[model samples]
Target chain A: MDISPDESIFLHIGPVALNATIVYTWITMAVILAISWLGTRKLTSESKMSRWQNLLEVLILGMKNQIRSISHQEPDKFLPFIGTLFLFIAVSIIMSIIPVYQPPTGSLSTTAALAICVFVAVPVYGIAKHGIIGYLKYYLKPTPFMLPFNVLGEISRTIALAVRLFGNVMSGSIIVAILLSIAPLFFPILMQALGLLTGLIQAYIFAILSVVYIASATRVHEEKEQKFEENRKGKE
Target chain B: MLINWFTVFAQIFNFLLLVFLLKHFLYGRIISAMNVREEKIASRLQEAEQKMMDAEHERDLYFQKNKENDERCAGLFASANLEAEAQKKELIENARRQVDEMKKRWNESLREERDVFLSNLRKRAEKQIYIILGKIFSDLSNTKLEQNIVETFLGKIKSLDHTERNHIKVILKESYNKAVISSTYEIPVEQQHIITAEIGDAVGETVEIRYINSQDHICGIEFKVKNYRIGWNVDDYVKFLEREVNKTLEEELAG
Candidate 1:
C-alpha cells in the first residue's frame, strides 16, 4: 500500500507527473471555491438572510475572531493567508470519509508546502512591519552568540510544523485502514469519526501556529515602539 | 519519497490563488454588508433619540401653555367676582336711596294732607261753634248773637287805649274819614248809631260810617278804617282749639 498520496501517480506528461495529492488538492480547492461562490453570490446587508449565508458569515467571522485573538491585531491583513490555510486543510481532511478519496494533507509534500508558506510569511510580515535590519535584530536579543541557535530553531520548528500535521493525518488514515481489516463494521466508522475530529483539530492547530509565528515577527516593532514611549514618559 | 517537490510547488501556487479568489469574493462582500448594516442601525438609533427629544420639548411647551391658561382664567374669575361685588353694593345703595327719597315724599304728602284736614276741621268747628253760640244765646237771653257781637265790638271800640284811639283817628283821617262797620247780620239803626257814636267819641272825630253785611264773620262784627281793624269772632277760639289739637297729635305721634 502506498503510505503517501504523492506516491500514487495518476498521469505522466513528459517531464511532469500528476499524483493523488495534487488531484485531491485541486478537488479541495474546487469545493471551497464553489461553496464560497454559492454562499456569497447575493450577499445582503439586511438582518434577514438565507441559512447558507448565515452559515458562511458565521464561519468567516469565527475565522476572523480567531486570527484577531491569536495575533493581537486586526484580522483583515492576515485573514486571507490564515483563513485559506484553515479552509483548505479542513476541507481536505473532511473529504476523507469517501471510500476511494485521499486527503492531500495526508501527504508530507502538502504539509511541507503549507509549513514553508507559514515560514516564509513570518519573515515577509516582519520585514514589512520593520526594516530588514530591524527584523534581523530580533535574533541577537540578549546576546549575539545565540544567533545560530535562533536560526536553527526557526528551521527546525518549520520542519516540525510540517511533520506534525502529516504524521497525525497519515497515522489516522493508516490506523483506520488497519482497523478495517481487523473489525470492518463499527470500529472503522468510530475511527473515521475520530479521524474527522482529529483532522479539524489539526487544521485549527496549523492555522493558529501560523498566526502565532507571523504575530511574533510583526509584534516586535509594536513592543519596541511601546517601550520607547514609556521611556520617553519616564524622562518627562 | 513521501515529499514531492513538484506537487508542493503546485499546491503553494494553488493555495495562494485560492486566497486571492476568496478575498475578492467572500470576506470583502460579507464584511462590507455587516458594516453597512451597523451604520444603518446607528443612524436609526440617532434619529429615534432626536424624535424623543422633540416630543419631550413639545410636551413641556404644552404644559407651560396649560399652566398659563389656568392662571389667566383664575385672574379673570377673581376680577369678575370683584366687579360683581361692586355692582351688587352699588345696586343696594341705589335701592336704599330710592326708598329714602320715596319715604320723604310720602311724609311730605302726609303733612300736607294733615294741614289741609286741620284747616277744614277748624273751618267746620268755627261754623259749628258759631251756630251753637247763636242758638245758646238766643235760647238763654232771648237775643241774637249778632246783636251781642255788635255790642261787644262797640264796647271794644270804646275801651281802646289813647294810643290805639289816636292810631284809628289818624287812619280815618288818612282814609278821608271813611269807616266801614261789617257784621254777619244787619244791625238796627239804633245799634248802628250807638256804634258810630262810641267809635267817634273814642277817636274824637266825626267819622263817616258805612255798614256792611259779611258772611265770612262767624256770629261776629268787624269795623275797618283803612288798614286798621277791630273785630270780635268765634273763629279765633276755633283756631286756638285747632292749634292745641295739632300740638297734642304731634306729641302722641312722637311718643
Candidate 2:
C-alpha cells in the first residue's frame, strides 16, 4: 500500500505529474469554495439568522477569536491564511473517511507547502510591522553571536511543523490500512474514527503554531512600542 | 522521501488561491454583516436613550405644570373662599343695616302714629272741654252777669291811657261813630244800651251800636269799632283755663 497520496500518480507530463494528492487537493479546494459560495450567497445582516448561517458564523467567529487571543492582534489581517490552513487540513481529514477519497494532508508535499506559507507569512508580517531592518534585528537580540542559532531555530521549527503534520496524518492512514488488512471491518472503522480525531487535532495544532509564529514576529515590535509609550509617559 | 517539489509548489499556489477565494466569499461577507448588525444595535440604543431623555423632560415639564396648576388652583380656591367670606359678611352687614333702618322707620312711623293719635285725642278732649265751657258760659250768661261784664269793661276803658282812648275815638270817628257788638248769644236790649252808654262815657263819644249774634265767640262778646274791637265775656275766663291746661300738659311732656 502507498504510504501517502503523492505515491499514487495517475498521469505524468514532463516533470509535472498529476498524483492522488494533487487531485484530492483540487477536490478539497473545489468543495470548500462551493460550500463557501453557497453558505455566503444569502447572508442576512439582521440579528436573526438561519441555522446554517448561524453555524457558519459560530465557526468563523470562533476561529477568529482564537487567532486574536493567541496573537493579541486583530484577527482579520491573518484570518484568510489561518482559516484556509485549518479548513483545508480539516476537510482533507474528514473526506478521508469516504471510500473513494484520499486525504491530501497525508502527503508530505501538502504539509510542507502549508508550513512554507506560514514560514513566509511570518517574515512578511514582521517586515510589514517593523520594517525589514527592525525584523532582522530580532535575530541579533541578546548578542550578535546568537544570530545563526536563531536562524537555524526558525528553519528547524518550519521543518518540524511540516514533518509533524505529515507524519501524524500519514501514520493514521497507514495504521488504518494495516488494520483493514488484518480485520477488515470493525477495527478499520474504529481506526478511521481515531484517525479523524487525530486529523482534527493536527489541524488545530497547525493553525495554532502558525498563529504563534506570526504573533512572535509581531509581538516584539508591539512590546517595544508599548515600552516606548510608557517611557514617554514617565518622562511626561 | 515522499516529498515532491513540484507538488509542494503547486499546493502552495493552491493554498494561496483558496485563501483568496474564502476571504472574498466568506469572511468578508460575514464580518461586514456582523458590523452592520452592530451598527444598527448601537443606533437603536442611542435612539432609545434620546427617547428616554425626551420622555423624562416631558415628564418634568408636566410635573412642573401640574405643580403650577395646583398652586394656581389653591390660590384661586383661597381667594374665592376669602371673597365668599367677605361677601357673606357684607351681606350680613347689609341685612343688619337694612333691618336696623327698617326698625328705625317702623319706630318713627309708630311714634308719628302715636303722636297723631294723641294729638287727635287731645283735640277731642279740648273740643269736649270747649263744649263744657260753652255750656257753662251759656248757663252763667244772664243780664246781671252781662251788666257786671259791662261795668268791668267800662272800668278797663276808664283805666285806659289818653292815647288809647284817642285811638278808639279816632277809629270810631273813621266809621261815622258806628260800632258793632258780636256775641255767641243774644244780648238783651237793655244790656246792649247800657254797654253802649258806658263805652260813650269812657271814650267821650257816642257810638252808634249794631248787635250781631256770632256763634264763633263762644259766649263771649266783641265790640268792633272799625278795625278796633273791645269787649269782655265769660269766654275770656274759659280761654285762660284752657291755656293753663295746655301749658301743664306741655310741661309734663317736657319733663
Best by lDDT: 1
Across B1-255, the per-residue lDDT of candidate 1 in tens digits comes to 788899999888878888888888877887887788889888888888888898899999999999999999999999999999999999999999999899778767866887898888888888888888888898889677778887788778778999998888889889988989888888889998988888888888898899989988676888887778888988778878988989987786567
Please give, for residues A124-211, the per-residue lDDT of candidate 2 as tens digits: 9999988999888888875799999999999999999999999999999889888888999798998899999999999999999999
TM-score of chain A of each: 0.94, 0.93
Where does candidate 1 clash, by residue pair?
A: none
- DockQ of each model vs. true complex: 0.67, 0.67
Tens digits of per-residue lDDT for model 2, B51-95: 999999999999999999999999999999999999999999999
TM values, all candidates: 0.70, 0.67
* DockQ, Cα level, model 2: 0.67
